[model samples]
Target: MIYINFNGSLHFKTDAIFTSQNRFAFGDGFIESFRVFNDKITFETLHENRIKASCEVLFLELEKFNLEEEVSKVLIANKLKNARVRIHFFRVGNGRYLPETNQCNFLVEAEDDNVQAFHLHTIETISLSKQYFKASHSLGNIKSSSALLFVLAAKEANKNTWNDAILLNENKAICEATSSNVFIRKSDGLLLTPPLNSGCVAGVMRQKVLQLLQQNSYQIYEQNFTVSELENAAEIFLTNATKGIQSVVKFNNKKLENNIAIELVSLLNKEIGL
Candidate 1:
């Protein structure tokens, strides 16, 4: 039997914590996901800060609740040492489009994972998503539950038999991948990723990668670029909290390299003491 933590209380996964009235009516909530390594939550401080920012954006008050302790309790209850943990925070009261209360409730779920550390993996192929585009807005930076754009982009990728799809912003500039931040390396060894104004999620791993690159004195820039620029890249990588770095082997017919990505994985593991 699997157990989950709902608003600081333990219950079976089958238990219903919220009803239709108070549930996530319009997908009005946000999520935080991270990996737990050897019973420790990786990047705990970053995750917590992101959660706090997300709550503030949605006007949900945490009010002295201990998120880290709740997560630890869920991990202990599930007996999971290495796991993928997700926490969903939603407003508690309901009132059509506008919520009646700013108070929130959360559910924590943890599942066992096989990966013990960050590793480099190559995506065989990826393509630009043509069907949908992510809107460039402040809300786009939040990990909100309403992710239909990404969901549709993933479907488009699967339909084309591609490993993943690159999503463009409404302005037709590169934003991010289906579920990760996009990065490209030019032949001259310069790294480029879309800025927050380009409507990409403020990914924790993306932040860490930028810091790592700067610490190592690598040239990197966060600026908007076109598809033509991406096609000319010598290497392309996607980063998220769960998957450290994933290199794309092919984009359209262009072959890419993974040398930098592989090196970053080593640096990341060492920095995390993994």
Candidate 2:
């Protein structure tokens, strides 16, 4: 096999890395991620909507940004079909943390893939401040650049032999993982997860599962639960756009009962016609 690298920019295509000069970039943009499977995209609208909302939440005032169209164009330019995709919008820093009013950039990357599962580890973490209980707070529940805090926690999970970390709120209630929403199966048939009021990212998959639970009249709870509840949970599972639904085999050095998780997977699979 052979590969070649070239300088200078061209039009938007697989061969073109940028649309303008090196110092050229816009001041405001949004990013999105999607999973392509069997030549189809699941929950495509959800991913697009999240990108739009993320930009709006970050207060990035831009004249126009089209994420879905850009993604489609990039896929075609690269002669690609299905995989995981990420799109990030960039703008010039306003000489500070904020962005300037003019110029912007769009960054997109995708790859065909295959994945089995993710490993999870228990980690130490500090919850958010009481003032951040509301989503209207600057970084609360926005799914933005605030992942640094989660990164620190994920280090603890890795140090202690885990893939990621779970964070709690100021009240010591189980919130969510570093990059995903969490669920715990109870003795009852209800599926349990933290509510948006708990200061966690409102994940799209989480939304889908919740909708399924509600539609079938399955007992479900969206209230605060403690770490102890997580440990003693009859079943523990995790979900994200990338990972889908994963059963937690072990947590805090204890093995979880994956029976409920397996059943829930079957239930969800049946519901989604997967």
Candidate 3:
């Protein structure tokens, strides 16, 4: 009895809600995904704000709809407790490059998930992506449906037998990983990550982790750096809403430590009351 919420209504998962003129034609939308643990949507406020901000950027009007309530409906209909929820928001109308209306339609879906709390994972190896570079533009910060850059980068990483691929901006500065925000920890206990201007997605988990680091009196900086700069880093980790923290063990041939990441996981789970 899989169910989905489409434009404020619940329907079977197989219900058709999009036309070729909409989603498939222009990829004219954005999406947000987050975890639900113990019947609670983690960071619900942050996710709501990000979705609204992204809709504003894309000119998709959400009006007065309640996001959390809608997601709850889908979760309840599907009888899910711990789950991975996704919301797809797209403009509805008739037009080419220009949309006929700014009104937005959204679809909410949830799937059962086994992960109940944030856990630290290890990546054996990672490499820089050579085929594509993330565009250094404001639009790059939005989680738009057009994600070919990341899709190709992930494919390249798998083909090269690397755990993941690091994406660089047009300026040749480290942007982020295929699906997570990048963080580098120096031997001196300093933390560094690419600024939003570096063309990295403004990840929700990245925001929360930064806040936690600051509260714990950790020195952190949102700055752009090149791969050469990483040689001096003592440790590196990636963060995203789904995975929380993933420590990278090797970059090229240099082995990195995960002491800080391991500590952060415990702090993160505690902060979330998990």
TM-score of each: 0.97, 0.75, 0.96
Candidate 2 structure lDDT: 0.60
Count of clashes, each model: 0, 10, 0
**In terms of lDDT, which candidate is strongest?**
1
Ranking by lDDT: 1, 3, 2
Backbone clashes in model 1: 0
Once fitted onto the true fold, the runs of candidate 1 whose alpha carbons sit more than 4 angstroms away are none
Candidate 2 residue lDDT tens string, 183-253: 88876655689988788776777887787667767778898887777777777777777666777766665
Worst 10 residues of 3 by lDDT: 16-25
lDDT of 1 by residue, 1-274 (tens): 8999988899999987778877486788998888888877888888888988888888888776786799888888888888888898888876788678888888899988877898897889999999989899999999988878889899999999999999999899999998899999998999999999999999998988999999999999999999998999999999999888999999996899998899999998888798
Model-by-model lDDT, in order? Answer: 0.89, 0.60, 0.89
Q: What is the lDDT of residue 23 in candidate 3?
A: 49
Badly placed stretches (over 4 Å) of model 2 are 1-31, 62-66, 92-94, 102-104, 114-138, 263-274
Cα error of candidate 2 at position 108, Å: 1.7
